[model samples]
Structure formats: C-alpha cells, structure tokens
Target: MYAVYLFSITWAIVQSLPQGAPPSVCQTLMPFHGGGIRPQGGLSPYTIVPRRQGNHIVVTMTSALGIPFQGFLLQGRTPDRDIIGQFDSSSVNEGHPLDCGTPSDSITHNSPNDKNSIDVVWSPPRGYEGPVIFNATIAQEYETFWVGLESDPVHVTKRGANDPQFSFPLHNNGPTPPNYIPRQVKQNSAEFDPFYQGCSVTKLCFGSPANCVESKNCKAAVAVTVAGDKYDFELKAESSAVWVGVGLSEDDKMGDDSVVECVKRGNGIAAFMSYTNGNPNYGAPRLPNPQLGIQLLNSSIQDGAIYCRVRRDALTIVNGKAFDLIGKKYNLLIAAGSSLKQSSVGFHDLTYLASAQSQALADVSALAAKSKLLIRLHGCFMIAAWLGTASVGILLARYYRQTWMGRQILGKDVWFAWHRIFMLLTWALTIAAFVLIFVELKAWSGERNPHAILGTITTILCFIQPIGAYFRPHPGTAKRPIFNWLHWSIGNAAHILAIVTLFFAVKLTKAELPDFVDWILVAYVVLHVISHLILSLMNCIADRSSERRVTSFPMKDLGGPGRNSAYSDRSSDAPYSNFRRGLLAVYIVIILAIVIALIVITALAPIAESWTSFKSAVAPTNAN
Candidate 1:
C-alpha cells in the first residue's frame, strides 16, 4: 500500500510538469510548421516557420545545434516583385512578434547573441498573391546555413480573412533568375550583391609559397564582374607581397598589354597604378603612362586571403589607342611579387586564365595541336641521335675497328671517319630538338623541372665530346692512354645521361601516349641491355683466346722459324670470326624494331584528345 501511494505521487508530479502542461505563448500562437532543414558542413541546421500575426509575417528561425548565429540574410521573391532583408537581432522575442524589414550593411548582428531561436517579421509587398520563395543565407565563423522554400508550397489560414493564406517556400533550390538583382555593394563592405553573379578561377603556382614544399599557400583567385561599361575585378590571394596586378593581353605574351596594379605596403599604406607595357624582350618592363579611370576601391587581408577590389571603365584609352573590353576577349594575366624596395620585376610566379572566352585560349589550343606534332618529331630525332648515331659510333670504334671487314671494305681510317660523321649528325639533331622545344613553349621559365635539367646537361656533354675527340692523342703515345680514358669516360657519361633523359621524357609524355608505347620502350631498353651484356661477354672471350694463343707459342718462333703465318692468322681469327658479325646484325634488327614500334605507337595515340584532360586539369572554375 505504501509503494503504490509513492508511485501515484511521482506520476502526478511528472504529469504536472511543462511537457504535459499548457504550451508556451510563442508555440501556441505560431504553431505552423515551416519545413525541414537542409544541413551544411560546419553549420548548425535550422528551420524557419512564418506565422501570420496581424499585418506582418513573423519568421521564427530555430537552430538544431542551439548555437547563436552570427548573421542571417533572407531573400524572397513573389510573382511580381522580390524582397531582400535580414533579421533584426535586437527585436528578437519569444512571446511578441519582432519588427523586420530594416536595411543595413553590417551582417554581424549581436554576434554570439547566445540565442537558439530568433524572430524576424517581413511585411509582404502590397497586392502579391502567388507563393513566395524565401532563400536565407545564414553564417557563423566556420559554418554557413542555407534555408529556403522548395517548389512545393505550404498553406496557412489567414488570421481574420475568409480566404486561405500560405507562407513562403522553404526549400533552397538551385540558382534561378530573381525578380530583382541587387546593385554593386560598397567595397570592403559586408553586404554583397546577389545579382550579376560572375565566374572565378584559381591558380596554384609551381613553386610553393615561401619555397616550402609542404606549404600550398601560393594561390590566387580571379573573380570578374561585368556591369555595363565598367569591369569590376576582385583578386584574392594567399601571398605576403605588397602588390598584385591583373593585365589584359592580346596574346599569351605579357609585354603588349595594359596592367592595373594594386600596391599595398606595411601599416595600410596603399596606392594604385596603371601601366602600359613596353618591350619585355629588351630591358625591364616600362610603364610610360599611368592609366586613367581606374580606381582601387578597397583592399584587405583576412583569414590568409588577400582581397583587392578594383574598378575600371570598359574602354581603356592609352597614348591615343583605345582598348575595348566588352566585345573583344583578352587574355587575363595575373602576377604577384614583393614590393619591398619598390621593385616590380621580381615576380614569384605568372599564370594566364585559360578558358574559351579568355585570350590565352588560342595559345592553349595551338599548344595542344603543336605539341603533339613536336613531341613525335622530337622523340624520333632524339632516338636517332642518341641510340642510333651514338650507339653505332661507339660500337664501330670498339669491336669493328680491328675486324677483317673494317680493314678491307672500310679501310684503316674509314671507321674513325664514319664515327665522326655519325656523331656530327647526332649533334645536329640534338640541337634541332632543343630548339624545337624552346619554340613550342615560347618561354624558358621551366628550367628547374627534371626534364629540362637533364636535357640541358646531356646537350652540354654532347658538345664537349666532339671537341675532346678533335684533340685526341696519337696512337702508341704515352698520353694516348690518358686520352682514351678521358674519351671513354665522357662518352659513357653522355650516353647514360641521354638514356636517363629519354626515360624521363617517356614518363612526362605518358599521359599523352598509349599504354603500348611504354611497353615498347621497356622492351627496347631490355633488348639494349641484353645486347650489351652479350657484346661484353664476347669481348672477354676474344681477349682470353688471343692471350692463350700468344702464350702457347714464343713471340720469335711465331714470327720467325717454324711458325706458319696462315695457321697463326686462322687460329687468331677463328674465335671471333662470324660471331661479331651475327651479333651486330641482331643489334641492328632490334634497333629497327624499336624505331618501328615507336612510330606505330605515336601514329595510333590520340594526342589531340589528350589535351582536353590536360586543359581541364590545369583550368578549374569555382562558382557560388
């Protein structure tokens, strides 16, 4: 009986609590469900319910995370007109409806306001009856919230009218044309124009920021807005430099262009300069005349992003020449460098915008088409130069110099002559390939990459080899040993470097080549290695046989008394007579096969289509 009495008392207390009791004033008064919440990363989910309280529509926004929101922007559109406003944090209340519809530039409203819910009231435009779509953009430090009405509309009964009423749509849908587009907001202001949206491009430099490999902060974003005859540019970058500039160019070349640069120094010291480029091929770039009608509105650095807003007239007049921006498309060049000691020549990196409408688009397309042809030609020339000419020259010098065929058909001096001619041909082809790359790239900036470095080293070594050969010492002289050592060392070094360069070239062009090309190259290398090993073994056997024959008979007897000259010649020649010829023939066949395979692969590879992926990888667009 005592336990039953205790249970009854506890149940009565629980029933009398707030959950079972009467609802709060706000809940009872504004009981309509707005919609579900669409959550975003680093942001608290929220639901907004619009209550028809008297003449105004009170919007109650409740956050699921129960964290204070820093800012709220509501953009709604009716059938006839658009409404854009923010919630007034000071007028937030639980019981009574708060007044709304105040225009302010500041987005932070009592930040960290420590309120889980806030109320905003919107006065509908006079005489609009269709469903209203509300798109809300709310934000905090690390989080952003987007809430709006979807295509489906929610209905609500009018407070006193006999007709049925409905609140604004609650789903945040994709981008659509709004009834009203906001004008350009003031520079450095928290307010942003929702209309006249533009595109943005991000470029990452080859060199890391501050030269640290792990630091990827060396990047920039170029956002452009076209408004009438005015072009507004906002450049945000992760840089420590005092100035950044954007240039408009007819081609990828930098000098023949107009530059609008922003200069910012320590302690907020700033200046804007406009310059026309002189000859870049000559001395430093000259800005003869400062541009007119270009204004730097605002510049700031926040959260590692350096923001600069600059506006200029679409038509730029410089030295009696006018450049129009509206109809004509120009390449966008962006550069950032230190402003210490007031130097503009030391740019950290340079990049151009690559898009269909960009000025550099032509260059990109041309490069794609031209590079394919150049790569094939270059590969063929390099293979002939390095593997064909050099290998044949070295082999003739090493094995065939003393052979019967070398002495008879080629004569005593013919081996050296042919070797020299082949090497000279190699030098010519190497120089041609080098020049072709320079012409294709149109610049000598990427000298630090592995491909460029190896090619440069190999070219230098190739140049030195023929010069050394010209000064080679006479045979049987004491200095001949030293000369031969130096010659062999340098020649081997050049050959090895050439092979390494070819390997890297294959790797660099792998994306552009088919899978079979790689296998073909590997087969060539393997065959070359096997042929070399066989030649070395044959050389060792010939040397041993010659030494054994010389030791078996006394030198005087072999030349003088009982030595049959014919027998001596036959014994000396039998060991390596036909073997060297057979091996050389096999080596020639292998080389021809490799060359044919390379040609076939190059012909079959889709070099032109590969550029599409390359362009997409390098050029990316970020839109909000």
Candidate 2:
C-alpha cells in the first residue's frame, strides 16, 4: 500500500510539469515558426511556386534552436503594398480560438499551449498586390504574438526553367547590387536585448523595482527578432538572455550548439551576425582583421528578457569542402540535448570565393603537411646522429686493440719502438674525432653545448699521456715526475669527460636497450674491458722478467774501479723482489682502473634502471 502511494505521487508530479520544460538542452519551437526580412519595407525579387497545391504552399522547417518554440506564420500581401492574405495556426493565442475565417478548424489547439505543431491555410483578401512575407514568432505570451507578413500589391513572376526568378539562391531573393543593401543597425552593442532590440525601459518590465532581482536562482533572459523575406523568427529566452547582433545566425537563426548550450549553461555569448561600424559580417581567417560573424549563445533565461552571454569561438566551416561533421555535430547534439537543430545553423556562403581561388587551398594544405614531417625528422636525426658518433669512437678503439695496433705498441721490449708511432696516431685521430663531436654538438645545442665542450676538451687532454712520453725531458731527465703528473691529470680528465658525455648523450637520446645496436654496444664494451685486463697482465709479467735479468747481473757491482770483476761472474738467474713488486703494483693499478671504468659506464648508461635486477655472486668458503 505504501509503494503504490509513492508511485501515484511520482506520476502526479510528472503530469503536472510543463510539456516542453524539463531541463532539455534544446527543443523545437512550434507555435511561432515563421520569419520575415528586415527594413519592414522594400521588395526583393522573389516568387513562390507551390508544388504541393495551388494557392497553398507548404514548407518544412528544421530548427537548430536550443528550445521548442511556438508555431509558425505564413503571410502574403498584394503588389500595391496592401495586406491580402495571412495564415495563423490554431494555437496562435496559446490555446485560444482564432478570429473569424482563419484556418481554425485545421489544428486542434490544447489549453495551456497544447499541440506542439499546427497546419494552417489562408485565403487572400481582394485587391492585394506585392511580394509576400513569411516568418516565425515566439508565443511565450498570447499578447506579444503580434508580427507582420507583407505589405503590397503582391508582385509575381511567371515561373520558368533557367529564368531569373527560378535562379534565385535557395534561401535568398535575387542578389542586390553591391552598396544597395541598407545598413540600419550600424553600431554594435553587447548590452542590447536580442529578441526585443527596439523595446525601451517603458515597454518592457524586467523585474521588481525594489531589489531588481528576478529571483534567487533566476538568470537574465533575452529576446530575438529576426526579419527576412520568407523567413522570420522571434525567439525568446525560455531560460536565459539572448544575444542579438547582425551576423549570420542573427540574420538567419543558424547557431552552433556549443555556443547555445555553453551560454544556456550560464556564460556570456558574443553575437556576430550582421554588418556593424568597423565590423563587417565576413572576413578571412588567420589574418589580422576584425572577425565578421556573430558568436553569442543564450546563457541565462529570466523574466521577460533572455540574457545573451558571449561565446569566444567564432562558428566557422569550410566552403566548397565537405567536412565530416559527424563527430562534431554529434558532440554538439549531445551538448545541446537536441537533434535536427543543426540544419538551421547558418553556414558561410563562400561558393564564389572558393571557386575563384581553389588552387590556393591545395598549396596551403600541402605546406602544413610538409611542416609536420620536417619536425618529426628533426627529432629522429638528433638522437641517431649523437649515438652514431659515440659508436665510431667505441668501434675504432675496439678494432685497433683487437688487431695489429695493440700488438705493435705493446710487443716485445725494444727501445720504445712502436709505442711512439701508435701513440702519435691515436693522438691525431682523437683530435680530429673530438673536433667533429664538438662542431656537431654546437649546432645541435646552440649556445648551451656544455656536454659537447666538456667531452671534446677531455678527449684532447687524454692524448697528453702519449705526448708526455714523447717529450720526457730527452730521456733520463729530472722532469720525469712532472711529465707523469701531466699524463695522469690528462688521462683522468679524459676518462671523466667520456663518462659524463655518455650520460648526457643517453638523456638527450632517450636511449633504451630495445634495439640491436644497443646490445652490440654492450658486447663491445665487455670485450674491450676483458682485452685491456689480459694485455695489462701480460705487460706486467714481461716487465718483471726484464727487471730480473738486469738486477741479477748487478752491473754496478761487477764493474768496480780497482778490482777487475768480469761480467760473467755476475748471477743472471736470481729474481729481484723490488722489480717484481713494482711491476705487480702497476698491473694492479691498471686492473683496478679498468674495473672502475666498467662500473662507471654501466651506472651511467641507459640500462642503469635495470641495476636493481642484476645479481652478484659471492664465493662460498668450504668448511672441513
């Protein structure tokens, strides 16, 4: 019994609400569905030939309006500028009966504005002539439904194929010569009410005079009055204010849903429909010029006036180019909560301009495509170039050591034979290589090429190791210690710079081990380290052997001044502790440096992120 009572109450509330007022984003206007041309006079060449029936013309209208409107009106007058015939729907008075002889029987009007649509027929009065007038008007109140159709001894042109009358633009009269169209509303004003622009403070009441607040939650409302030949509409804000201007949508009620709903949801809208002082109705895009279009949306509806809020976006579309408006219009429909409203949204008529300069569009579009491709290529080249350079040095070092160069420089001890040659060659190559890296990085990084500068400087200083040996105070000189220090400093700087450069290179390149090249690089580094360690051990052993031979002979002791000690008396087989220890120390230092180099490289490389996953094995001691 309780559930049944609750359901009954819910149904009562639903039934009590207005038919077309349920917070919809958009709705069709039915009562005042006709429109008229402005200036309220002057005739344009136009003729309407009824295909459905003689003396009766029927036209279907699709509104892009955000809300449902009142019914439409169809009017015609004589050529002598006298009213001849007029048709009104049954609900012109918002559920009231029409006056005598107006097609009252055709439509079944409902009380409180029932009947969302209506059909009406008219009979022309005698002695009427002039161009016919037609329009739509708002029926928010029966008292404000006053609108005009036409005034004249109605003019008519005989319909013919290819005739000037038949050639009239789909929704326009014969084109008026330039400079002939009158400009009435010259100054653009954002404050003007859209629906009733001509209304003064005395004519309309906004709200109570006391606080001037419509209500706690109420918003401003705007009214729009558009007059055009064969099309006229008087739209009012059922919820918010209306934006009135002399732009396309203003002249011909065609507005985008984004603008409408964004405003209806409570925002300011800008109107850019018709011509105004220093502001035309049409202009080029991406240029420094005044925007020539109306961009206003109905923001808030309150009292009698519909307040219009300005929209920042100018509603634009391509002419002579069909865009896939499916997604765009779908989004608009969803936002506005209405379908079939997009048709009435006005489009720019650029058929003439497009036809004249069709080729320019193609060029502009091609340029844009090419520009995007260039940007993509530049990014790709930057990484590939740097990595390629570093790879050259690694590859060269590996090749030289693995082949004859390493053997020649470190072969059997002679008098510092190939060491000098190998050192010179390596120094020359390094200079040239570093210079190349520096120049390229300068270009890539411009003024802030710190990585390039540091790497290049370090590489140059690294060659000092060989240079120090070449100029070692002309052999057995006192400056030998000084040369060692110079060599040590240069080598350290080179190693540190190389490590730093590799790190920055990794960052700049966003390197990863996903590619085959990265795997190859890792393999090369491992091989280089292993070869360096083995060769260093061999050199240490050879040095110890030579030192033992020299020490065992004891040349200073054998060749004394007084006693004649023969060279043959000297012991040649005994090992020398000092010589062995000195050679072992050098070997250990070399081994340690190689290990350190490997560690630093691995830590700085792009694969450093995987360090935590790597396992280190520890040798277990066997217990008895």
TM-scores for all candidates: the values are: 0.45, 0.26
For residues 213-267, could you state the per-residue lDDT of candidate 2 as single tens digits?
1121112222122111111112232332222221222111122211222222233
Q: Where in model 1 is the C-alpha error above 4 Å?
A: 1-48, 52-227, 231-247, 254-380, 402-421, 437-444, 450-454, 467-474, 477-479, 503-527, 545-624
Q: Pick the candidate with the highest TM-score.
A: 1
Error of 2 at 556 (Å): 20
What does each candidate score in C-alpha RMSD?
Answer: 19.3, 27.5
lDDT (10s digit) by residue, model 1, range 1-624: 423533543343233321211122111111111011112322236555566665655666555556565444444444432443333334554222122332421122333234566676554444445565444444332112332321223334354453445555455433322222223225522112111121211111121111111221224434454333466565555546555666676654455566666655553424344443444342124245444766655455544335566667878775455667755767665555553333343443322222223432112121111124555677677778887778777775665543543243344345567777778988888888887766655665332237678888888888888888788766545566676777777777888888777766654422135445666667767877787677667766765876643221212222333333323453234358578778878887878777766655554444333343344446555321
lDDT of 1: 0.49
**lDDT, residue 425, candidate 2:** 48
Roughly what TM-score does model 2 have, to 2 decimal places? 0.26
Clashing pairs for predicted structure model 1, backbone only: 148-170, 148-171, 149-169, 149-170, 149-171, 150-171, 331-359
Cα-based RMSD of candidate 1: 19.3
The candidate 1 region of ten consecutive residues with least summed lDDT is: 27-36
In candidate 2, position 279 carries an lDDT of: 23
